[model samples]
Target: MVDLDPEYVAARGVLLDALEALADHREAIVLVGAQAVYLQTVPLPGYQPYTTDADLAINPSLLGPRPGLEEAMRRAGFRLKDEDTGHPEPGIWEARIRVAQRRDDLVVPVDLIVPEAVAPPGGRRGARLAGEHGRRAARRATGLEGALVDHSLIEVGALDEGDSRRTTVNVAGLAALLVAKLHKIGDRADRPDRLTDKDAGDVLRLFMSATSQDMTQRLIDLLEDARSAGATRAAIDRLDPLFGTPRSLGTQMAVRALAGVLDPATVQATCRTFAAQVLAALGGAG
Candidate 1:
């Protein structure tokens, strides 16, 4: 078993605390982004360990009152961030919460991202959830129902093996995490400045860590499941171009973004192999 690093352990603790605080709204939330990646891959080899934030995709309809959510976070030791001046703003639907940990000076950020309006066809912009309509769109495209089945229940902050009070959080399924990562990387061509090296590196690590065979099977399974669950054909089609032969500009950007993560030769080989697997899976789906 892979050992959980101190940073991930602390982050998981914070995430668990947040989940416990929001237990009343658990059904409406789906953990996503880097934190979800960490949770799903923690037991696997080559799991990258650099994120200090937890991101959750929340249904706007269930978010209820902002004040109540804020109060819950505050009670769990998180302070709401009033402003974010960072480039490519987080948008209006996203909220950041910070907590001071006793072990270090680093403040952990937990981001709650409500799905905004769906982007136009072939748009490569960020996933910003606008209002209730956007939330519905997100649920449809992401096959939210499938996520509920593929999730793993993790017990956090347990004092002992039998600790009954240990908090449990439902992590996003691996397939959901994979789709989200691919979407982010696929959108890199449209927002190169905002899509940083970390994003590319994460995608690379995700592909490299899982064998092409395993990934191919997983994608096929996810696609089949999504289709059966009434996910839009458009949503499934969007993923095809990303796996196109010769690779798209976004794929190149992802490769270029991995300069220091791995040797150039290895990165190229891994990308090629992974892309081939994806294309094959797409063909099989067809």
Candidate 2:
């Protein structure tokens, strides 16, 4: 692993508090985004540093409206930030906190999401939770159903010295994380506003930090599971155009994200090799 950076430490600190706040509902929350990726990776020599907001997929059925979730988040130093979607109630909320007496406040965003497969069916952009006091409190996201099923407990804590709070939070398994990143890459192809090279870089990081055999097998296992099988199918379908070649858009995106920190040649080569290896292992099917 690389030396702990202050920014990453700050992000983890905020995440730690949120996890603790929702400790009772840990069963319903699965850590899903870049923060999860950063925690799981064993940094390579040229690992680029990137840590931001948190995303957690919740099983609303398990986190039923009672005792309230927003109240707990408010008690943990978070405030609700509605995205101005014109809904009378906004489902979005962001967690903010101070780490290590930093001069500026860290707006540690925690996006509470619901998998489209399990989210209450409606045309509303975000999912609703009665406990959040009529506000949506969660958004519906695709390809997250797999995350809810493919997760494991991880002991997590802040890196800031003297803050020794630790908790076992459920994070998406490697296979699921890879699948979600691929799903994001595919989903963003039409949404230029949300598309970024970061997700592609994240895919490369997963392939680079672990053995292809291990990753391939993990994905195969997920494919065998019912809850995540559809997501697995959708995820694998995106492999080729993304990383089939060094010149592929996904491969090039990964290379670009690491341009200054790693040799572009190394990033491109690794992405192509590993993407093909995983695809071959699964035979391009879920």
Candidate 3:
């Protein structure tokens, strides 16, 4: 595995501290988004610095109202921010806490998302384009509240740091994470501004970390299951263009951010391999 940057370590420490504060809701929350990607990729080679936001998904059915959640986060040093403003908007609630004693005014964002049973279309065009089968698959993949309920708890941080604070939190399984990425990428057609290259990069990193055979089998299983659930071949076909399309502005920014740390060639190769696997898994339907 590649050595982790000190900044990444400190960022993770902040995230863990936040998670520790919400220990009462630990079981009800599953880590998703970029921070979750960081955790999943830590054991693998290559380094991708995490964004400021730490995303957590909750099952509203199990957790009930989120008013208490906001209060709990406020007590933990996070102040809620309005999503209409330029901030990290993961779902319904967005919050951030400035790191104490940091000269840069560096802040860590926390996004509390309630995975909806049915995800709204990316846009009017996306709604018309996706049709019923595509919408259902997107909903099934992104509605991870139930799918990720039984996530694994992993210890983060180490005993050597001065803080030596190692905290464990529930993380969505790789399969679920992959599905979520796919759903996000597919929805980009409607919300081009919101979709970033980091989504594509995360997918590449996840694919590279998984052994080819394992990824192939896992994706095949996932696709087969979705196919059985009335996800038509057309629904599967919609994802094809996302893989081959030009990089979005967000992706370009992400690449520039990691320019020195990650090899460009490796990133490209992993994307190509993943695209091939995706096509195969869908039986070359596209």
Candidate 4:
């Protein structure tokens, strides 16, 4: 609920309008990616110097199958970006929607992600929310109609400092997004191919930023166990860069262990030699 510029107000309106309109025929839509992160209040949502575009998750069935939806976005004033399809699986596709740019300290691009490649969240997590948060979000819920309803940018205003709802929205939103990311991982893994670097990086970024400390410790432990259990070299390689960088000692050790698996001979020899030197100075390998 950040206050937006007057000029960009109508642009945000238009983007909301399109999604609301699309939602009419679609079962459900969840905003995802950077926009979702910002909505979730991850430590660095708006921390980025500048960003363009908002990403949303929508079911393809809601869009009436393939290229028609892409044409729809074009009609709505979005310049769809065409990139080389990184994954060649039959059901994956993406369309980027850029509605407007704002002029403040820096220009930020607002993008709308068409949910083609990735599926939205499902089940009780997706079904409904609970407590005061559930009540408030429901009142604010645009359903499909609410999303289409226009409000002046000036009217939206900055989120009230006293309000707790923003945090609630962000926390719930982030939790759901993490589930989606995990799902995407499984989907890609089940295919003939492995998860892409982009997918892995996205998960790591979210994990470091949004997860609670206890959860973070658990992830570190899980990665350590995965390394010991003989996980794939690529998996261990991905975890290596996270260790000993500038974080906690526990994080450093986790990275060191994974690095060992990725380069066993070098890592083992170096670590063992280092350990032996220390042991000799004091007494042994215990």
- The numbered model that scores best in TM-score is 2
Q: What's the best-to-worst order under lDDT?
A: 2, 3, 1, 4
Give the per-residue lDDT digits (tens) of candidate 1, residues 227-282.
Answer: 22343233335444553333655355456665555565666666666766766666
Model 3, 108-169: lDDT tens digits are 55556545433343632111112222211111134343234325887767422567777787
lDDT of 1 at 275: 64
Better candidate number, 1 or 3, judged by lDDT:
3
List candidate 2 segments past 4 Å from native.
Answer: 1-5, 46-48, 83-91, 98-104, 130-135, 284-286
lDDT at residue 148 of model 2 (Cα atoms)? 72
Clash pairs, candidate 3, are 197-250, 197-251
Model 3: ten consecutive residues of lowest lDDT: 131-140
TM-score of 1: 0.62
* C-alpha lDDT of all candidate models, in order: 0.53, 0.77, 0.54, 0.33
Question: Candidate 1: where is the Cα deviation over 4 Å?
Answer: 1-10, 42-48, 59-68, 83-107, 115-149, 156-166, 209-261
Q: At residue 176, what lDDT does model 3 achieve? A: 58
Over 96-131, each residue of candidate 2 has an lDDT whose tens digit, in order, gives 566555797667677788887777767566675545
Question: Whose TM-score is higher: candidate 1's or candidate 2's?
Answer: 2
Clashes of each: 4, 1, 2, 13
Ranked by TM-score, top first = 2, 3, 1, 4
